[model samples]
Target: MRRSTRLSLALVLTAAAALAFGCGQQGRLTSPNDHASALSARPAFDPSSVRVVAAMASQDRATPALLALSGVVGTGTSIDAAGDPVIVVYTERARVANLPEAIDGVPTTVVVSGTVVPYARPGGGPLQMGTSTGNDLECAAGTLGCVVVKGGVDYFLSNNHVFARENAASLGERIDAPGRYDAHPICNQTPQCANLSQFQAVSFSSNNTVDCAIARPISGLNYSAAEAGGYTPASTTVAAAVGLAVKKTGRTSGLTHGTIEAINVTIRVQYTDGIATFVNQIQTPGNFIRSGDSGSLMVTETGNNPVGLCFAGGSGASFANPIGPVLQALGVAIK
Candidate 1:
């Protein structure tokens, strides 16, 4: 007989954490026969150009001072309407007085984004990507970004907070599909839920570039790379560039589209355990993600090539780790 356990409301309430923060079945993974391929053309803006690199350097140098300013939250590189590289400063309020118009000869702009927080509001099949998932020990939930292959083994991809409990989970910990919050009373006790085991997760105790983790599937259960809404991400990864159109499918926000607002970003994100700083990240404006949407993969809208791994967000902005760094950090390739 299957054991059933009812979760208490307090456990659910305690699960609230930053968005930057998921399991299934003995079923073979299935994907569409025709998966999306990378776009044949390159973006107009060359992020590797000298001008863009100089602007990125300027942003990096000024980040310390800018983050110290009142209302300032983060800083990054962006492209202005004139198609020139510029420095972007993010603030909690509408404006921060006395911010410079330019940094090291590069132009500057300000964006009113509230305090950035991890989106961990915290999902089935051979469980699909971009669905609800979470640690079985807690009531919180978050999105399972996608699948990656390492050493010929398949693993589920998502933020550390979602699978590792912000570095609190041990290796081989159980992860539940639909997360505890989404599962509610039944939680991880249902046959429909797929259970996964923790594999690799970056520790939050040190400075990290990506808030990412990978979980191995229990025997018999499998996962598919196909995201919700039928979007298929390419196996290759691309660097983020300002003005690049992108889209993501997540647990909270389904499939939402937005343009790359900034890149080479340096920002501090509030997690359940503490504040952590991430450098060289990707930023998007408006409602790209909401609570429980962290871990959604940000891919190029045109060809669905992977670009960034969604993690944190603030009032007018959402943030992600560049896919290259995320993959390198976890030593995995997109499946």
Candidate 2:
């Protein structure tokens, strides 16, 4: 699906911090342990923060400081005594330069670690999180990626746009691994490709915020929770947060890592036929993600912790639906 222009509003707040991990008066949440507590506190930022961030990105302005920060992936509410949204900057360097106290009304928060590079998976060698995946037909390939459990079965996790044609696909459709695009290159000679049938469609839902679908796997095909490039699955899910380090393996982008740019973002996406508006979505920088990267499972780069389901991206930005809603809608769990 082609992405439409993102719609968002700017929201400014106060407070700031920069470091590997620590705490301060301005508000600093550097540990996963603090997520639950911070969430409970409800970071204080206007809902329009998404728009604010988008506008800043387009105008090349740095009012929130996040825009000016090169390594900063995005901004989100921070855990201050009073929960308020802080501009979060993500970087791979140990030491950052020219740290600011605050931008506009929002403060700055910095996270150090992880290079963001996007690549594609085009050939067939092994079945891993970065392997190609797609319909049995001519649709573009994506990542077959991720392992989830539903009804005691090992179902492959991916985006509905990938497996279900974005709500247009039917249940029980044939699913291919190494996707049709990769499985067969002589597509022009014939309408079909050498698709390796690996899984059968189970269910999909675009009803909620997620664009996810699952399929029951068949025997004889190799599969694993491990992602490409040696990142093993943590077999758990993590909440999306600013400054959180995350990774994903996709048909186009093998194993790439980046940080959460924005959460609870509402945006519009263009499918082949029409448009769909997604709300409460997770947005990230356009680092390694690209076409054929959709349906890749977004996970923590360090522990392989599941975070979100990547679906749409364009214009230096990518978006994913929260994993919680995707699992809830499908009644599944990370395997």
Model 1: ten consecutive residues of lowest lDDT: 15-24
Model 2 per-residue lDDT tens digits across residues 1-335: 21213211221122121221123223433333233343345544443566444433432345355436655543333444465545445554545677666656566555552442212222323456766666654435777657788778778888777777656566767776655454212121111212221222222224248677887776665566777757766767899998788888776766788989899897877776566778888988986578888888888878778888888898799999898888887888888
Q: Which regions of candidate 2 are displaced past 4 Å?
A: 1-126, 188-208
Any runs in candidate 1 off by more than 4 Å, and if so which?
1-125, 186-206
lDDT of 2 at 12: 19
Candidates in order have lDDT scores of 0.70, 0.61
Model 1 TM-score, 2 decimals: 0.61
* Deviation in Å, model 2, residue 29 alpha carbon: 52
lDDT of 1 by residue, 1-335 (tens): 01124444444321111100100011111122111121112234456788977877787678778777888766656455455776766666775887999999998766554554222221013567888887776666788888888999888888877887777777777877777676423342222233444433444456668888888877787557899757888998879999999999999888999999998888888876678888898999858988888888999998999999898999898999898988887889999
